[model samples]
Target chain A: MVSSQSGRRSRRWKAMHDLSPRDPHAGALPYGKLNLRRNPFGELEADDWAALALPAVDLDDVARRLREPGFRVQFVGPSGSGKTTHLLALQARLPEARYARCDSGRPLAKAAILLLDEARGFPRGGGSCALGVHEKIAGCAMTVELGAVPLDRLDLIVRSRVERFRRGDGPVPEVCLSRLGALLERHGGDLRLVFAELYEDIQDAAM
Target chain B: MPRCDLTIEFDQGKRSFAPGDAIRGLIRVRVEADADCKALKLACAWRTHGKGNVDKGLVQETVLYEGTWQAGEDRVYPFSIAVPRGPATYHGHLVNVDWYLGVRADIPWAIDPKAEEEILVSWPEGERSPDLGPAFSAPAARRPINEAHAFVVAKVLLLLGLVGGGGLLWEAYRSLGGKNVSGAVQYGIMGLSLAGVSLGVAYLLARNVLAQRTLGPVRFEVPRQYARRGEQFAASLGFNPVAPADMTKAVLKLKCKEEAVSGGGTNATTHTHPLGEWVLAEEPRRDLAPGMGVSLAGRVLIPADAAATFASSDNRVIWSVEAEIRLAGKPDWKKEVRIAVLP
Candidate 1:
């Protein structure tokens, strides 16, 4: 009887030993190794200002003009061109400014400093408004035409994000940096596309 | 400021056509002041627009008028172009293939003013054009090698080795009979060999009984390539076994998932989320003989709240039915069929 029981135990041990070669972390990221609290590239709330990589545009001049009552300024750029990022950053500096959608039915007459998004949709009216649009609108006190971020700036942005997620022990691999540069060129310096591709590469490497 | 207005109108007052159909349109231009016009051009092209990068193919182009135009010049240019017999129009979540007729007034020292109107192109009923094959091909099924034979062979060899070693040890024990010291040593050796042989046999039997069944190819039939949300559908599965075997489990499942591409450049990320799932069958098991086959049919209800199939440049929502069969002591046989869920 003892021999039979021992044999069963030995068989079970062998089965378990055969299964041990599989990766326990397959399909899941090794978050503990990277030492990150959460994915850094995920959607950011208003307070998550630290992750914002502002472009080299003159934010000071735009902010100064926006502070004045009845002063109209417009930020024009294509989608994913950091128009919203700059707008959000400017909003952080000027708390009194009101952010309003152009199509919203709400009354904007009483707004002291109106921040209108999708400026092309806004009706022509009297008020000091900061507009965000894909194309330049006529009659603005100042227009800042935003374009794609430069490759050098994009590299720094990628490096900073990686550093934020890096565990202190291991140096970031050279392959990752080179891959980021190649991706930047392929995507024409579109920062959003660059970051998304980087996040996927990191996850694949972890796998 | 110089002013120019361009308008495009389809001949039949409709903007839909099929392959080999001729697209006829009129381009009207009205100018308010004398302008150094580079050219008045009409172009027909198909382009994709959505979350993905833009891709365009110019089908044809014709110049309506070139050189200069005077003030109060108003002219109408009519055009007729035969649509290609392929490249059917498609509308998806992140990608759209659309044909357009555009008129551009190339003006010197200013932005070129242009007007464009979209037209739909489709294949005729029950027709499959060769050009649309790559764009509309069905997803390929997954196939992986079966390694059960290798596993069984290894276990059988180990069992044989244990039995042969045990027999050799027993012969040695019998050679040294009746001496107290030698007997004790021989008895211990015999007992160890017996234990090893018992363990090997038990393992071999358990593996043979639990994991050695061979499975055949799994095939599934779904109602249509696309289903509307909240629509009820039927799906069936048929499979053949290489030999008669006992099936421990069989099931079919319907699942919807969303895949999105986030980030840009070399650092793009693709993320997936399971939107909904339903089990069509469970606990289906049977014992069969060699060459025996099984077929199962079931009705599938798409949840009313399920997200409709959507595909953009870097994002997609996909729905599929999975057929899984598990045999006693063998790897599971699994197959999947993809279906699009429309809103």
Candidate 2:
């Protein structure tokens, strides 16, 4: 399994090498924005995509999870945590994808995958609504997150509201949280168990 | 977190005292825990309340203590403030003395907490000495009468001219028997009436315009109460020294008139009356404009010890001493006065 992991890493590195600039790390070093290409709403011109540096994430698995129906995923942690990286990686891997910021208590409609990065910055009980979107596109190759996610592990124990909704333990609507949990579990890959532990800590903090 | 408390006290119970007293005080500060601390400063400030008067208020400030204290230590700082001598009154009264201590912190964006004590001062019972002898209590300031006088005179004369013209028109209508006057006699009468109106208007305009250009509008203020020439002085008399306090009850009245009207000092004109052919030269003359108040200015050099009455020359000019209750308006003391003999 270790050799396979290394092989997969090598293959990923090789695939990036096939492009003009082999060392994706050059683009990855959070100098400015890394991945976001054109605006999702097609508002941006073609040349706007600066560069792309994909992190290790189970993109196909994330797609499958999103396809399961009623898909929802929330990214929670301090600023610059890998939550955005994971979500954006999943977005790029999917065939049909839509991106939006979630706020207030509103339903996520028509969107195949509901990815909310920086969920902690949003107010509590604002419901779920993306008040406005600048750009959106259909029939596109992939949409990348335009910023860096820190490599450091987030001490997710502080996010109590997230954990409460995850275990079916709190007054969360059964439909929304369960779907979000399954979606998170799908893309979480090796980090799934760690997320589970952090989720438990969050529950304790809430209690 | 470390905390510090400060307390201050003054020895002299009074804040403002005689110029020779020493301001005694104690300042104490108690710190709760051991910590890096900075210096403490004790300051006594003196500031005037009503500054920028004809006589400006004075200020004297002094710094009494400056040093540092160890954490968890209580320290008492003692100091004194000195009052200077002379005609100077602290502020307007005697003195307003306030003292305070500031404990500075090493951290930026933090203000040093301070303790303050405010006190009033006392002066010697008889020490109040104002520089000037009572000229008169400031007169009841009058609403400026210059513009108003011009307006009134113009309206009055205009009304008089209109009335005179109406009378002449009535006479002409009756004499002409409803037919328009067609001869030289009819023309002559009309010409005379027109000339009369013009002369009256010209005189009115000249008087007002000259007054405005020369000494400006004269100010006449009748005292509310007027004491006869031999009436008992100061205490025994019921007269307002500045302006008549009881103007409604004043015995004397005020009247103004234009006389010896003419233009001079470069701009001069001579015109002959149309009906009488009397040639008059418009010479510049110093006289009150009609409807304007009288202008009076004199320095009464009374013997420093007693009040005295003085007489004025040019007394019989009938310069109307009508004790009317008109406002004196503002006075321009800086403007030179001819210093005519007192009436």
Candidate 3:
């Protein structure tokens, strides 16, 4: 019975067959010798951000332009250049839409497909629908401007974070796409500073 | 086909444990349809996984089974847990600590039939690795200075920081002397020279007035508050020089770090790493007189593969010991001891 889901950590947390192939707290990890099972650029939770946010737009065209209701759009960029991973992959493909970070004090979530993140607690003639601004947010009605990070979508965000931490499935670890095109030309493409500089070189080659 | 099938068994398949040890378990259930097991929980946690932002602890819990069940049902619930004494089970390189024994079935309308099993607490083989005692309370005889009553409170804070920074630079030259000082008196003489140089460097750093004008009373000794891991303790530093100092190098360090804060509370972010540094002794130059009295001692070690003093409330594993003094041009005298390492 390998079914799972508890304490809100289910973006399909797996790779455990009675764990302990010797790592009893911090031992082996060269990304588990590149068969990968951790650190494909660490620090993830919130159930792995809608399964590793690799959205270069078209989440059904921004959920069909926020489907009516004074329809606004705006998914600009800057702080990490993916705009909250295309607004959490369009709030995980519209699970009844209602996501609001708004600089984390929330409040301003009337729904009807709201999804504002860092919206500065949204004000300024209120009304919003699918926005993840960072600057210059003036009343959008469809903007979508995620510049810089475009090297085949940073190779599809490092091939979907190394295929979501693979650890079962023959032959892994081989995507040096020219060292990720030199880390997207040395971080000017901000996929969160190129995944925080490859999570500090995979935590210094797993320490 | 309504789904629900949870399983977690560990009683003699024990998976290894220790720290009060006792983690028996068994929770099997199957439900292809008819089910109403409201609150069937059983937890025992410990979490934290790389890069930061997942510090957990839920020591023990139980509630085996709850209500009804029917339709291809089979059940069993028995558990025993009690194993804590950590921040243990680490696997650092950003962070990692784990321990699990879970089971859940708050199945109402479906979607909550969890079951987990992963244990290995260790720390019980010639046991010696759980002290994490002191973290801070700064001591150098923590607040007890009476060298002629702190030299009359450091001469009333050096005459209240040079007469309140020369009476606010002579009240900004008698109120921006004869106008033409432009807009708001040129912002009132640059806000009175930045509030008279920030009130004379915040009243001359209140009490360490350049470490009592260059090392006068500092007898810091670190009498082992806790340390072990190829331990080799002992630290010292003595001083007495109410005047005349020309030194330009003196040291003694020993640090170990890991901070991790990551998100929450107005968007928190602390992230320090450091993990190693040990000088444990150093000295050079000289020229100190005034009833001279100096001392220095060594021996610090701690590296038998160090890294054990931990504390949780967002993760930390510090261990400090610093004692510096490099004067020549004044201002450089430090002290910070905080030891607690075991493991």
Candidate 4:
């Protein structure tokens, strides 16, 4: 007869061995020895981080949308197009909400609001348990179709929105194109105007 | 119609063997659904490369073995070829030993055919002959052995390409001094390095993956058959052919009214069609019933200019035409037409 402590230890051993990290659904995606640890954000300082991050767009409207459950949107662009950075900046405006990579080991039904970055690398075929959750939560995913918008327009829009948000007196619950046009000129057309007046509205409502 | 499909793998068992050592192993074969194939014969022999007088002059041996097999069945017939004696020898290099199976089908067509396999032979290191014999020496080297070093150097060029691509990406990032150009450069480098690592893993798995040899179902409808004369023959937008455009070669099925009524198999070929022609299979006669169906298959070359069109080509208009048609109802009633128009 085994002692209670020994029996508990045996159960723990069985559980750990059953779990593996190579399984994408249950394990980390095998990116295979990537040198991605370099500080990509090292060049930017902390205080300027907040100001340089949020484009001059109105955040109240965007914040409003995020509060309403089932709200979803995507920012499509090629690699280095700033989809993740833009999403992170958007997150800064929403202090209460939290984010995390959807865990691979747990059933997808067990998680909500998955953010797929390299969606092309998704596994082609897998068991039904993983598939069911993927379909159910697919709508909540915000994926950017790279190459949808030109880079010049994207920079212009990001800068203009930040300018308006800084002014703090644009259209309420709606986008104000006139103010966006002024901000576009202020930046001297050096950047692309991606979100323009609209992104700010979405952010303001969500915040 | 039931057909015989065979796969012959060249497994050069051991590095070396004595002249009389038994060359033994199972020759594997697979038959398709419901076949009335008669006896299958396995034939194997060694022959030197090239044409005429030099061919089969150094023949090792040729043997015919008989075996009876059925359809949907996989059978491995064990074989043992007695290594011949005399000055004949197999050096520790790839020597060709071609083997194929012959199956006689009950089908009326004399197509009852033979399947073949090319096996490679090599001998282990043992007694070194002071004078190299023609049998054991490498395939006659037209060029000196040193010539292969040049080919290896050419393959090394892939690395230069990788470095050049990386440098170009970095320059683009630096020129565009946006929010974080450095971050983009870092990610780009990481992605490329990861790809290299994955390729290595794929190379390791290739030895285990056997190549599959079998014909897929044939489509009866020829694409773009109604093309105006002078118009180029082209496949519809959604249908993607697996064959390369330049190597456009396809076997098309054709038929005539009497041929279709009697359930006969007939086929015909069309001269290569220029890229732009829209081809559609046409009925042999205009008076045919509306419900009648026919089949055809053939290769058409997509014009070289097709790739030069607007960035994606899908958005551009084509000005050339070439066409071919196969009507099952009329085997001999085949047509190949062409069309040209101002851009």
Candidate 5:
């Protein structure tokens, strides 16, 4: 069982010109005051998958859980608990693998390495190393339980995202330890909701 | 796993560009370890960031290099990109449009090596801006369509009266035409009652008769249709009453929103993000006497940093004013008037 890198924390912000090409603020913010390029936690585009900052779980462990020829690896977690992100990061590493997000009452599609997200009760796809990120599924061969994210874990995740969009060696807006505690408490460890609160905070406070 | 490092640099030092301009750049690559590159691509594009779902467009793209690379090998691919017509770059509270020069090395059985550098597109100040595109008008203005509503109400009433009158004529000529006068009269009254009910329903649906009955004409003025950012624009609103309007207060807001239609066919969704808003006026009052409604005058300054209105084939940033009059015991009066804000 591979463990997440909890001891390592210091990740340096990249340095660039004062007004580097990354500050997309039309003419709003003066140059890059805080080295802010784009909001790291904003909506994801296709290319954005390469920089997901999943510091909490080791992707290699996830890959290990899906190697068997006809295995079913279910990931049971609440909404916004980094299930889809885990699938996406793995798909980035394994380009040929397919990733599908299940909608309201939609059937699962077949793939070599099927990374299914938001699955309904008890995913039914048999064989083909299906890593189902589902809800309310019972014990299985391997179940990666994503519980409420801790403050330190959240900090690492934020840093990985901010690293990709750094404007310069300047500071990056981060969810402080104190603030993270409140956010986690208020949202019941829902990372998506926490990010939304932080997103608004940065937008409101950014120059 | 196979791996490669991708880096991009523009020939020009300044990243700011205007529409129709071309960017000359070089993509430098280094393969740290052995890797089989399926394909390498360089692209110029724009994407929106902020609270809304991301919307993006690839302006230009080309395949740069492909095939295997030995360890410690360095490669350079120089190219030029013709920038697309405007949506330029915008940064607002709920929306931010950005341009980028991205390079990627797609590798099989390995993580894709990718790098992206943001760029600036400056326009709206230079050219008139991009085309408004097709299916364009979303109509930001909320000026009651006063005349159209009036016409609809009058037409509905006239139709009801005409139908009811025909029934009445039959009833009056009952003795001359039919022997069943009582039956004909009952039928006429029933027709009249049905018509009267429909008339009320029509007025309720087509227009706000309650508002008309309580207050006089509601008027708003934006002196100039076109406005430049960082400039002051004068707007005045006047209200008169037919009877004493049981109103509490009136509020006015000026907002800029980004509209982009995403997906297609039946799954198409028009995502509207209200980026920034400013309260131009909010006056509290108890009530207005008959023919004694209030008049308001104010100057609204388009923030120096505000994103000017933008429109492209599939996107638009619209500016409009919304007015809401709160009534003590009646449905509030609301209106939205569109205005043009140039970069």
Candidate 6:
């Protein structure tokens, strides 16, 4: 499945290459060259999860369990640990599941499978359901703990996106990659913040 | 109840007058019971209403009659007052300047019976009061530029430059296989250099063309064109970038300012004081590829105790939305749209 997907992506890249300007440096920057329909660094919608390429993580298993009836699960992690991403991914996988923020005032009893985000703020006795939170609740049937993204994993994510714009030929600039690594360390492994800062640097460099 | 009823009527039943004209009117009083009428006063004044705070200016006042009143007495008093040669009447979004002729009968130990009639004061041809200033004057209509047409033209030029430059390089490559290897190499080198330079130039032209094509016109969609004081205002901004470019930052802001003229005649200096400001959007840099545009929504909660929108001849409190877009290798684009905030 990965091979076929890569093959299709390569073909699309070839088509874009042919339409690009002759000057190699003209369209070299990734700013105006990426897919315009979606923002890679910010929040992703339900349909965008299928195309996400990141380090190996077992979110699919959690997603599958979240679909089952009466399975009260809680995903606990620090900020920017992809907890929200996983919850959103689960929402995509389980179309029948109802999703809401902790303060949304949605009646949990009405939903066959409820996905509550920011569950730490949720009041007690709101009925059992899956929750995405920074800390585990006491009575959750299952607790899924996510750790901070390592610098190597962050590097892979950045390389994957940069490589897409380069059409798999040239290496991403060493200075740019090094700067991103430094940012990861400076931000204490806050992956989302690191990405935001990296995106700003890229935008500035392109300008 | 008042012992007498008073009414003021303008001459010739004309409710409108120009500056420097005489305001001729009659005051009529009907005495219903025996009462001590101290004085009959006629006051001419101009006042503002609707927003901010009320402002009033007395044009003229006079005592038309003074004496005791009989139970069945009726009196009509005629008076004439010269309208000031300045300060023409104005109507605006949050302010209005109106003139009135008020007649009041001072009845001792009872409610003073009073009547007021509104009168319109307008500017004569080629005679505008300097106090009215440019802010109160009606804005002239402007013709909008057709940006889409300009975009198409820029795109076409870019395509032509790319095609023409590519053809030259292809032709130069094909000639490299000919005899006289060194000569051919020399000729090819020269052709390659020329093609390289031309391609570079063409690429820059195309990039600039795309930049121009994609950059503006920014549109601000305000939820309400008019707002009450202390009410939150929201607006959505849409920026059309026909070609890809890096957007370093985008921001939305709301500001209220007081503009006034100080000093007199030739030494008059206009001053502006910022009353309040709110930052609506301050986003990190992002890439906007070709065919990509930006649509962002933002809101600002006007301070509950903030000043309302007000305008007069010499003073004004204005509310506006300022949107700024920063693009790579191009000048930042900024625009402001004015809105009304009522009290």
Q: What tier of docking accuracy does candidate 5 attain?
A: incorrect
The candidate that achieves the highest DockQ relative to the unseen native structure: 5
Q: lDDT tens string, model 4, B1-343?
A: 3455554432354313344456555556665654544454444333321001111322343333344446678766565665443222211001112111222233334345454433333333332332122323221222322323533443454455456556655655764576576666675676466446444433233211110001111232334422222234443111122221221222232210000010001211111112323333322322223223233334344432231111010011123222222222221111122122111
Candidate 6, residue B338: the lDDT equals 75
lDDT of 2 by residue, B179-222 (tens): 65664347447746765775566455444334333334334333
In terms of docking quality, model 3 is: incorrect
Best of the candidates, TM-score: 5
Candidate 6's fnat?
0.00
Model 5 interface Cα RMSD in Å: 6.1
Better of 4 and 6 by lDDT: 6
Instruction: Give candidate 4 regions above 4 Å deviation.
Output: A1-207, B9-18, B33-39, B50-54, B57-68, B85-115, B122-343
On residues A1-207, what C-alpha lDDT tens digit does candidate 4 reach at each position? 336643533332222122223312211111101111111111122222344543333445544555655455454444333444444555565555433223323233322223232232333222111111212234433433333333355445444433432211222122234544554455444222323223222322221
True contacts kept of each: 0.00, 0.00, 0.34, 0.00, 0.43, 0.00
Docking class of 4: incorrect
DockQ of 2: 0.01
Question: Model 2 misses residue A184 by how many Å?
Answer: 56
Q: Can you give the TM-score per candidate against the true fold?
A: 0.42, 0.25, 0.36, 0.19, 0.67, 0.33
Task: Compute DockQ for each candidate against the true complex.
Answer: 0.02, 0.01, 0.14, 0.01, 0.20, 0.01
How far is B209's C-alpha from truth in model 2 (Å)? 13
RMSD of each: 24.9, 35.9, 20.3, 33.7, 12.6, 31.2
Q: Candidate 6 residues B240-272, lDDT tens each?
A: 776677889888888888665432233234556
User: How would you encode candidate 6's per-residue C-alpha lDDT over A1-207 as one tens digit per residue?
Assistant: 856754544432333223333323224223223322112342233444334535134656766765565567787888777655566667676777666666445454455677777676443444336677887778777777778677677767765545543322432322244565677778887775676555444333322
Residue range B222-268, candidate 1, lDDT tens digits = 66766665778778877666677778887888887755554343324
What is model 2's native contact fraction?
0.00
